[model samples]
Target: MDLFLSAAFGFPTVLFTPMLIVVLGYWIFVIVGAADTEMLDSVDTGGDAAGLSAVLSKAGLGRVPVTVALTMLICVAWFVSMMGSIVTSLIETVSTPMLWALGAVVLLIALVAAWAVTSGVVMGFQRFLPKRRGDSKHELVGRTCLIRIGEAHEDFGQAEITTAGGAAISIPVRTTGGEVLSVGSTALIFDHDAADDHFLVTAFDPALDPGQH
Candidate 1:
């Protein structure tokens, strides 16, 4: 109550107040189903997926999604600012120049810490996430599956198909030529696009894909 307000609205840490608000707002949207993790991975700056991945890898944030990186950054900002407040408060008469220098150092530390945290978190979750087996994906080629996400774009999306064991496997998917499949739509995976590491899914038609019929 009082402590939260003090930390959030007080000096130094108050700089991250807006960031906290934004992060919280994003999670709220995610909870209510207005948004999803795909938004974080879909920011394109006129580069292909491989180029974007390369840039992210060079930045030490390749494994972490953009939203996860941003969330970790905001958390680090709040932590560093609060730490600065605690340390600065102990000083009897700190000058403005000295305070600025300390702030700069704290910001640098925050940046490094945020990157480390993001990497660590992504690695930690990797053990629990399912990996697509090369052999299995090859067999799924030309199989029809249901699109589970909001929309399956040519770049990134997900599809769901049930297995013999009654377990539903969700696989990352993509298409080409500006094709986008809405949620609940059926698609026939034509080929395994190895370059993009996703199944090249096409709209399913009864007459077209006799294998499915």
Candidate 2:
């Protein structure tokens, strides 16, 4: 204990060790979080079906909120402890060996704690994210929606469709075969083109489809 206290009270390394760990670990998390990996390719982001499977697969962080909070807490604590250690060391009159021992013990504890937190976050993310099911765009092909804005020509337009949960989405749409869809007219999502970021639609009267043929 004497050796530990003396080392901690004399060496500058002890004061900055925790701060280094925290900063370094945080950058690691950021890189993992933002990377678009192959594992995320299977998840879907279509309307209500969007979930965390893609996010976690790419970043390896369980829940976004938990990962963010834990990282921030670790960083804050590290810097705070680092500053505190420096002040305490300056005021102390301890022996060199003792201070060194204390610094070693503190660094070990901080390192272990940081590792545990990182592992926990990774595990949590893997466990909570759901497995991908299937493509939903295929099902939208025959569904009807209303033109919320301008006409849907071969090039550009917008429309609104109520999704499975009744949530509405204003998405870019186009006429499947150059048919013009006027405002408030009913249209069907005939095709979805990811590259163009728009849906190929067709004008259709629901009442006519129902009876008049």
Candidate 3:
């Protein structure tokens, strides 16, 4: 028990311990319905998350949700580091500095091994996961959505739309002609802005909906 605690709190393994805790907490929240599994699905192009996403994509781990990939990565890293630390503790003759150096080496190996293992697992299960349909973007056009953010204007907005599968998804939206689309207001997705990766919307009246008649 002492050795297990020591390894978990020791140098290299300690680096990943907090991450593992966070991953565990996130999953707990997911299981309780307090968080969404796809909460981190969207990556801001200019942020650090985007860089990490690019790296994961290059490593073939991008097909899965970022949350899933990161959870697997941290779990694998923590386990490997813990094992390495346990093995290092068995070497009694090593000086403090030498042990630190060895821990650093273990950390590096753990990271690489985690990525490799995650990539292989992701590839093996990719076919079983729901594939994102490219045509869905075009299909969203002409759909009615509810504004989910503050007032939507030419520059910024967000809305929620339900798909044929009954899953609600939030999407980036933009308005033209200075329309007043506020939270809870209905909007029509008239067109898709492929260049900006958002939907072009206009204010909608629920009474005007043909289905209401």
Candidate 4:
């Protein structure tokens, strides 16, 4: 064991002790947290929780939250090594040149490990995040819809439609005064009501075309 340690790190066993401890602790924390989030996606929660995930979603971490956390942990490790009396005691008494080289090597390894762990976690979770919801303003134009609820007469109503491929759609409905629709009535989609975020619809009947008798 001693010969292997010396050959690998070019240092005595004692010198490699701290590096192994820090690396082990870092891997345990990051891997366990990642596994926990992966399990949570299976159960439906009211969307309330706080932890590493909350940190990832803040305007800053869109692509990789784990990477941010790993970077932070590595920085903390370096600061602790430099400032903590115990860490200073362990490495400071050693030869200055050897200590400096070891510190540089350890810090580099920590950074690379952090980056790899972060990239893996982010790639794994990207697929599980819920996709953006709700129809866009442009898509509501010219599509047929049904009155789901509410009246459409110089006022407001709710409706649902399906795209030609059967994907469900939702839109708000309204009509000129004195017009109203009940459940299951078909309406022509015409315009969008920006103020209410609803769709303006007109009664559409296929039998009564302008060119037909």
lDDT of every predicted structure (CA atoms): 0.68, 0.58, 0.82, 0.52
lDDT of 3 by residue, 1-39 (tens): 999999999989999999999999999999999988766
TM-score for every candidate vs. truth? 0.53, 0.38, 0.71, 0.34
Report the C-alpha displacement of residue 136, candidate 3, in angstroms: 6.0
Tell me the tens digit of each residue's lDDT in model 1 across 119-162: 77767886675541122567677678889978998777789865
Clashes of each: 0, 9, 0, 1
lDDT score at residue 99, model 2, on the 0-100 scale: 63
Candidate 3 CA-lDDT value: 0.82
The candidate scoring highest on TM-score is 3
Worst 10 contiguous positions by lDDT, candidate 3: 42-51
Task: Indicate whether candidate 2 or candidate 3 has the larger TM-score.
Answer: 3
**TM-score, structure 4 vs. true:** 0.34
Q: In model 1, which runs have C-alpha deviations exceeding 4 angstroms?
A: 1-15, 43-55, 131-213
Q: For candidate 2, write residues 1-213 as lDDT tens digits.
A: 554455444344445445556557656767888432222223232642334434543444433433343454465445444544554466566687866665566566554555456656556674665543434666666777789767778887888776543345577888855578898998878788988767888878688655336
Residue 81, candidate 3: Cα error in Å is 0.5
For candidate 4, the 10 contiguous residues with the lowest summed lDDT are 40-49
Error of 4 at 52 (Å): 20
